[model samples]
Every structure is written in structure tokens, then in C-alpha cells.
Target: MLPDALPSRWYPIFSSAQLRRAPTVVERLGERLVLWRDAAGRAHAALDRCPHRGVSFKTATVNQAGELVCPYHGFTFSPKGPCAHAPVLGRDAKPPAMSLDIRNVTEAHGLIWAFTGAVEADTPPPPWFEGLGDDLRRCADIAEEWPVHHVQLTQSMLDIYHVGVLHRRTAPGSGQVITDFTMTTTEDEVHTEGRLGHEGAKGMPFVARLRLPGLVHLDVGFGLHVLVGVTPIDAKRSWVWARYEARLTPLPQLDGVIAWLGAKYDFTVLQHMEDLPLLKSIEPAVPEPGVDRLIAPDAGAAAYLRLYRRALSGRMEVAQ
Candidate 1:
């Protein structure tokens, strides 16, 4: 059931820079997937198992022709997963269909996205950050492996109350007790707005966009945004990718250097170092609602769960 809920949507399996000369192995939705790039730099994903003798693609190699070669049987497969050549059949014979089970894959925003289910020409494109454009430049891309359910890490982002407490020293002056907190939700998004201290102070508005199968966007103010994507490695592990980007300023000389430094410092000290240790300490993985008492400050996390459940229901409806 957990695995089925993750299909039919795109998941960022690798960053564009990570796929180089060799084939890479990725575990998503409880399956071992092999990702490789063709001669033209197009990415593809398929079950790691070879059709003959079930040898894992981890032991295989990408041949000069851009086809994945099975070391055990010398069968060559195309990017679309069909076996194109076999040594036993000589050069002229065509291999049978369904020789390799390939899935859908595409690249965008410097990330390699892989679809875990069937995809047609009309399948929707992966979700994009609304305000980002070509003018903006990527400053940092941080990828890490977490020891909890993907849901746990996602909900943490939505937990507005934790800011003042969990990140007091790392992210001081932010996440103070929010006043007049109100939360709004949509089929796949959530919004929360409030003040850090008393009334009349500057408002801190948080808008979180969620896509089925684990993709989220968190705006970090100052024309900077963070993109968080969680790929379920298995039932107990998840791979996380976070990207920090900022708009280009008028001064090209200092913009690039400043953006890089700010992104690296905040991400390393403020976010990754501060949050990872606390998140790793949470027990029982995914916690059920009402298991712990909730106060008014938890409005953001609560709203996130509602939208998340709605997405799951929508997926089930489509299946029916």
C-alpha cells in the first residue's frame, strides 16, 4: 500500500550533474532502478534486473552505442528498455519486446526526474516553482539521505511552530511564536500567514506547494527559494534533494559570489546541520494523528497533512 501510493507521479532521482560516464543505481518506491544517459545526454530509468538470469544492472555497463549491456548474457537494451541485440542471435535478428522494463524519465531545473508508473504522451509535466525563470541562477544543490519516512521530513518543513524552538540558535529571529496564525489549504497546496511577535509587526507568509509522490517548495524570503524533493528509497529510508536559488541582481560582478556564499552558509549551518540531527531523533517514523496533542501553533503542520491525504485520495480515485 505504501509503495502503490508513490506511483503515477514523477520523483527526482538524481541531479543532472550526478549522471556522468557510468550508470547509477537508485532505490525508489521499494524498487531498485538503474539510471543511465544516452549519447545525447537523455536520461532513462528501468528495473535493475536483467531479463535473462536476473543479473542486476549494477554489474552492467553502458556500451559505446549508448545501450546498457548485461555482463552475464551480452544482451543490449535501448533507452526505452527493449532489447535490441543479443550475441547468441548474431547481428541481424531483432530481440523480442518487453526485454527490459523501462520507466519514464525527464530532466528539468538541473534535476533528473523518473516516473514510477505508466506514462502516456498526455501525462502531466512535473511541478515547477511558480516564480522561478531563466533569469535566476542556482547557487547550491544539497543531497542527503535521511533515516526516517519521507512523510516525517516533509511535515517538519510545514511545522511553523518548530522554527523558534528547534532552530533558535541556527536560525535566530525567525520562527518566533506566531500571532494571529491562519492556515489555508487547496487540493495540493497550503498557505499560512502570521506575525512573529505582537500585532502590527511585519507579516511572515508561508506558502508550501506539494505534488503527489513527494515534492515540495518552501520560500525562504529575500528572493531566495528552496526546493525539497524526497525519494523513498524503501519503507524506512528516503533520499532528499534540496536546491537553493536566487534571482540575479543588477550587479553581475558581486551577485554570483554573494549568492553562492549566502546559500552555502545558511544551508550548511542554518538548515542541514540544525534540522538533520533533530529530525533523526524522532522515533516511530511516521506518527499517526492524535497520537500527540496539538496546540494552535501547529496549524501549518496540520494543514499540510490534510492536503497530503487529499492527494492520496485523488490518486486512488484515478485508479478506480
Candidate 2:
């Protein structure tokens, strides 16, 4: 679920594969922006609007310089976003004077990340995953647009009790409770952060634990991290983007297991189906300035919900 607002967090927006060749515009939360690769083969994100006529640069052409040229009036802008030239005017002539909020773009571990809000390069890295090893294969992508909020989907990750009742395969409880799980709730809007690691567990890593939301970061062992990004397309829809990162060994080596694990997690679509009835069933949440009391499992759920609420609030303030 993409929020009606934006978060100041740095999230994975696109994979390296999708950002190649031509420019692509992602419309999210009622906002428009463009992503394209430069001549040096570096991916760049910039405000999609052409300062000249407010036309989208995403619909423009990629020039020999690899800069995005607006299709409407043929206005070309550099990766830095300064209008490099106006086709009607010769190169020697004065170019359009404008710039876009070209955020810093970084490609890592086969993914492209865009820093939203006031993220600092010096900021500490995101959480570290365990049991993460090589051999993660990209079998199928379960990307869909949600008709609800992004937090709704994120909160679903830390839901352990529902595993047995909702998702029957992974943690099917034959009327028996699973092993002990450690769930911690802190004073952060990031409500839920818990882990259920069963030793000699049945699966790829022997024991699996929750690492991150939507990411499904499960550390199978040291240096092995499987991260999946459940990106939002808008307040009503989003995409489920996942990747298997190989840190110690090459992924090609464990294609079979990775494929198996990928299949194991194939319930993403099913998960959405589960959410469909609930999300669509939600009759536009009642704006209660703030939430009231929360239950036990709700403790973790509340933390994440609050984390996202604050994040969206900070963004809305800035956008205003």
C-alpha cells in the first residue's frame, strides 16, 4: 500500500534491470517523477515535470548525451536537471534555466535506492539480516497495487499468530502452538519487530527469523541475507519487489534451494488475496486524529503504524 503521503525513509524504488535503456516515470501517491540512465550508464531520478511547460519529461526522448528531452517542446535537461538546450535554439544559444530535485541515487546489491526526505549519507545503514546466504533465484514477482495504505501491508509481516490460521502452509498449526518467538515493541512508529527462529528448523537456512518487513529479511546464517521490497505504487496500490542477495557464495550455486524457498514464499499473491477482502472491506478509515488503545499483538503492530504515521506526517509538512 502506498500512502497518500510520502515517507522520509530511503526505500528501494526500482531494480537495476528496470532502470536501464529508457526513461520511466513512476506515479506514486499522486506524485510524478522520472528515472533514466545517463550516458555513463548511471541511473538518475529527477522531478518529471518540464519547467518549460509542466509536461512530463518521462514522455520525452533520450538524446545522444543520454539526457532526457521533453517530447512536447523538445527541451533537453541534463542528469543534473539543468535545461541543457532547447531544440529550437542552437547549442551555442542560451539554454533553459531550471533545475529539479534530483535526489542522490545509489545502486547496490543489484538494486537502486532513492533517498527520500532529508536522509544523510552518513546515516547508519538499515538493519542487518542473518542466515542470509547466496543462491537466491528470482523466480516470479508478486507486484500489485493496493487499495489501502502501505502500512497495512507492512504490518502484515510481523503477524505470527496469523501464520497458522491465515497462511496454512508455512506455520500450519495442527492444533499445536509453534516454538517460542521473541517480539519486542519499542517507542517508535515502527511498531512491530519480532522474530521466530526454530533451531534445526525445516527450510533453507535450518532456522528462519524475521529480519525486516515486506523485505522478509531472513538470516539463514552469517553473511546470508534475503531482502524483498514491497513497494507502493500509490495510496491504493503498490508493488511487491523482492531479491535474493548472495554475500558469501554465488547465488547460481543454490538455484534449486532458492527456487524452492521462492516457491515456499509464493503465498505473496495469496497474502494479497487475504488482504483484498479486508482492505477493500475497509470503509475509508475514520480519521481519529490519533489512535487509541492497542492490544497485545497490537503492540508490535502499533509501533510500525506509528513509525509510518510520523514518517508520512513529516513528509506532508514538507510538501505543504
Candidate 3:
């Protein structure tokens, strides 16, 4: 989420590598940014504006000194965003750090998260963090994008409505499926949690919950964790980035299989392919203020959407 202040920033932006193999310019909430990796290999996000004269630095070419330089006046700035030295001015004068607005940044789970708010150096990455990176050599879980508003896509993960219709063969259904669940919410968050008592041999329908206006963390089977990271691209579009990893399952000897099976069971790709059309066709409907149009089974759906709208109101910058 984001801090509702002029100086505050949010992690509602792109994950690492998603941008590219190199630096890129990303826009969110109407603000442009220069996202680049420093010489130390640390990822950094800056205001994208050169301190002197306000030229867009993301478009500025990188100079031999490893600093971003504006072609118009030859003013160079470091990765930290301070003017390294103004060739037109003098190398003797140093730019004040105060003049540069540096964002709190961290790269994890393949995302380069930055907060415009007063973020601490230790603010954890999105809750989806699970040893994910570009190497692709790590344990099976891979990150990919689903073309849909992140919040909507994520909510689908916990939406029991589809668990039976879309994935009738999986948990919460296993046996023709029943229609009973609960969706509750709070001021800052909403959760849809329920269980599918002895449906088949699948041992109870494991248990699931969706916390919105963002973040969907679900448990498919015996501690197998499926995390979906959502980032809004705009009002009607966004990214459904998810990580299918295994954790907390009581099957250690089958850990590898559990992870692989977990990923497979999630059928992440197959599920999204089917969901693409529906999500793409649906309108961008932001829940109205003080409305409770929920039915008996509409528990979690309503709660999740409400919390999500609150998240958006806080200025969660959409991850590009």
C-alpha cells in the first residue's frame, strides 16, 4: 500500500526484471520514475527528474562516469540522484542530498519495490517473497504476468465461485462441490476464509482466504502456499503476478514433489488462460462507498473488494 502524503511512496509498481535486463522509466499515479541498478548492483528508483532545470533523467543517457547526464546542459547525476558534478558549473560544488528525492527500494520475488512514503530501509517486499529471481535455476516457482487488473485476478484465486466452475477438479470442489462460505472484512483489509469439509479423498478443501484491495495468499493443500502479487496498470488494466511455491506442507520427504505438484495443481498457466477472457471483458467496477450488496455466498467477494478500494485510495502506485 502507499502513504497518503506528498513525500510518501508505495510499492504499487513493477517487479525487478519485469522492466527489463537494464534500467527503465516507469510511470505510476501520474509520476514518472527512473528505475535503474547502481554500480553496486543495487536497484534504485528516483524521481526521474534532474535536480538542475528538471529534465527527465530516465531519458538522459548514461555517461562514461556511470552517472546519468542530461544532453541539453551536460549536467551529470549519480545513481543516488544527486548531481555528480555539473560540467557547466564546477566540480567543486556538490549537490545537496535534500535536492534529490530518493525512493525506498528493494528487489525481491523478481520485483523492484519502491515506496514514495517515508519507507524504512527494512520495509519487507510484497508478502509474496519466496526466494524468486531471474536465474530460473532456483526451485520450481517461476514468476509470470497475467493480463488483468491485479486485484481482480488475485481475488479470483480466493473466489470460491470459480473454484468449482473453473477448477471443479481441484479443492473446494473435489466432489461436485457445495456452495457455502464466508467473506468478512475490516477497515484496512478484507478476508474470505472457509473450508470444504470431507468433499472427497482430498482431505478437507484445504482452506483459502483473500485479503484485498490487494494481496491474495492461499493454501491449496497441506501447507502449500500460493501467492499472487497484484499491481494496477491503470483503472481497467493491471498485472497478475503470482508465485506458486511450496511451504509449510507436512510432507518433507515429498517436498520436491509437493512443490512441483503444488505448482501443477495450481495449474497457474491453465487457470489464467481460461480467466483471461472473463477478466478482460469485465468492466472496471470500483465498489461504491457505503454499499453492502452481498448475498449469503457473497461474503468474501464483497469484503475483499472493499479493502481493495481502500488500498487504491491510499495511492498504491500501480506497478508498471
Candidate 4:
């Protein structure tokens, strides 16, 4: 099971494209949430259950005023969760003291992020790879639900040593031995840089960075960058959002094409064909310290685990 008090951070839950005019239902952080957009296209999130009758907001509709109208009893709620209307009473009648549990939400980098902290004012803007710019306009976005705990999925990304063996079929020549692996950690981030080595093969350098909770950025050289965010849906499942950016050429048009092709090949072929099978076989779903042996090459994953435990214990204070 995941820690009850997860690090208070913004967690990506769904692709922005997936949430449209209707109220979309999503499960994250072990809670059911309803997401919708206002007329201005800004997103909002609230608990999925209506406070009045406990009806699920999944069957609700968004009125012209952007209020969520419950399908069961026509109880209406505004974007901020206050009861806006109650059809059982007169149209203009005052609503009772009823409201949904509102959650802080925002759209960024082609994904919908929910702040998992208590005080919204204390939360910082969603974290992104400054190297990827303010948006993912030039990248190809893809999302999938992996049937493993989010911690497992995240650690896999930090474990670069698996590339050569796990991805050998899809990414040929990636199975080189690791060398000069170095990892640095701060209060809420982990940064790693290393080189790949193999006899008779030229050395290739790589870089990976992780922002607390579940965000990873990997630079594989040749103008290719990979960003991954793992959000926990429940103890046994997680949502993985990935963006692939390829800037092999000077022209923006060509770069866009390459990004799209690379996203398909890397995410669909390499990930689905290789990583998925092995990841699903991991035991205990969620990893605990001392459960597995660590070697020199597992430095990155080790750092993440250490930070995760600190966050869970409420000792890792995030700067306000």
C-alpha cells in the first residue's frame, strides 16, 4: 500500500485532451474525482460523490453556467464546489448547506494536474522540466495505465541499467554496461548523470532528473528528450503520462514529425514490447527499503527510494 500521507505535490492525473465539455471521472491518489472545464476552458476538480444524495458525479452534466448538475436529483454545484441549485426547491430557492470536496486542479504540459496538499495557497506551480519549455507543443504526448504501483514504474525509469538488456530488441546497441554513474539529491529532486560503456563500443553519456513524487526527465542525446510522470490511481495501478520530443533537424516542421514517430516507436514499441512485461512481474507492487539488494549501478533508484521515504515520513520539507 502507498503511504497515507503522500508528499504534498502536484500529481498529473489525465491527459488534457481527455477532459472536454463533459464531467470526466478519474481515480487518483485513491480518491474518485470529477474533472470539468468552465466556459473559459479552465479546468476544475471535485470529489466524485455529490454530498446531498451520494450520487456519483460521473453521471452528471455541466450546465451552460459551468455548474455540475447531478443526474440523480438535479442538485447543482459550481466549479468551487458550493451548491448552486436544488431543483427539489423553487428554481431561485436558496440551497442548503451542501458542497462537494473541491480539489485544486490546473492544466500544464498537455496534462491535468491535481494538487494533493491541504492548503492550495501553500502549493507551488506544477513542476516541469525547464529544458522542455513552458509547453509540449512540439512533442508527442501519450498516456497509459500500468497495472503496477506508481513507485515501481517511477523507479524503473530511474534504473537506466535495464536499457541495454530490457530494451535490446527495440533499442539496439543500448545494452552497454554502466560506468561513471553519479547521482545528486536535494530536498525534493534527484539528478543523475552517467556514461554507458561496452568493449569496442564508443561511450554514450546520459542524463536523468526526478522531481519529488513522480516526475522524470531523461535526455538520451541526439536531440531527443523523454519526460514521464507516474500518478498513482490506487495501490495496484498507476497512470503513466509520457512526452517524447525529437529535434533532430533545424526545421520545426521536421522536428514535429520526428517527435511523433519517436513517440510511437519508443512508447508503443519499446515500452509496451519490453518494459511492460518485466515491470508487471515485480513483487510486492510497492517497493520497501532493504527488500532488494543494491549495487553501484542502482544509485539512481536508491536515491529516489530514500527521498520517497523521507517525504512519506513528513521529514522532507518542500519550500513554500
In the order shown, the candidates' Cα RMSDs to the true structure are 3.0, 5.4, 6.1, 2.8
Question: Candidate 1 on 1-320: residue-level lDDT in tens?
Answer: 24434556778878888887468887776778888888887888888999877888887888877899988888999887788888999998866754787877899877888775677889888766665522334456778777767777777766655666767876676656577667766665666665563245664665555555566776655666667788777767788887666655766435546557766776678667887777778776656678657777677667666666666667778779
> Which stretch of 10 consecutive residues in model 1 shows the poorest summed lDDT?
130-139
TM-score for candidate 1, residues paired by index: 0.85
How does each model score on lDDT? 0.71, 0.55, 0.55, 0.82
- Candidate 3 Cα errors over 4 Å, as ranges: 1-12, 16-22, 27-32, 48-74, 88-101, 108-110, 120-147, 168-186, 196-203, 210-213, 247-269, 289-294, 310-320
Give the count of colliding residue pairs in each prediction.
Answer: 0, 24, 20, 1
Model 1, CA-based lDDT: 0.71
In terms of lDDT, model 2 sits at: 0.55
Candidate 3, residues 32-73, lDDT tens digits: the string is 677766555677677767677777765666655556667667
- Worst lDDT run of 10 residues, candidate 3, spans 1-10
For each candidate in turn, the TM-score is: 0.85, 0.72, 0.67, 0.93
Best first by lDDT, ranked = 4, 1, 3, 2
Q: Is candidate 1 or candidate 2 better by TM-score?
A: 1
- Model 4 lDDT at residue 147: 86
- Taking the tens digit of each residue's C-alpha lDDT, what string does model 2 give over 175-226? 2233433445333323223333334443222122232323445333444344
lDDT: the better of candidates 3 and 4? 4
Off by over 4 Å in 4: 1-5, 120-122, 133-135, 315-320
The better candidate by lDDT, 1 or 3, is 1
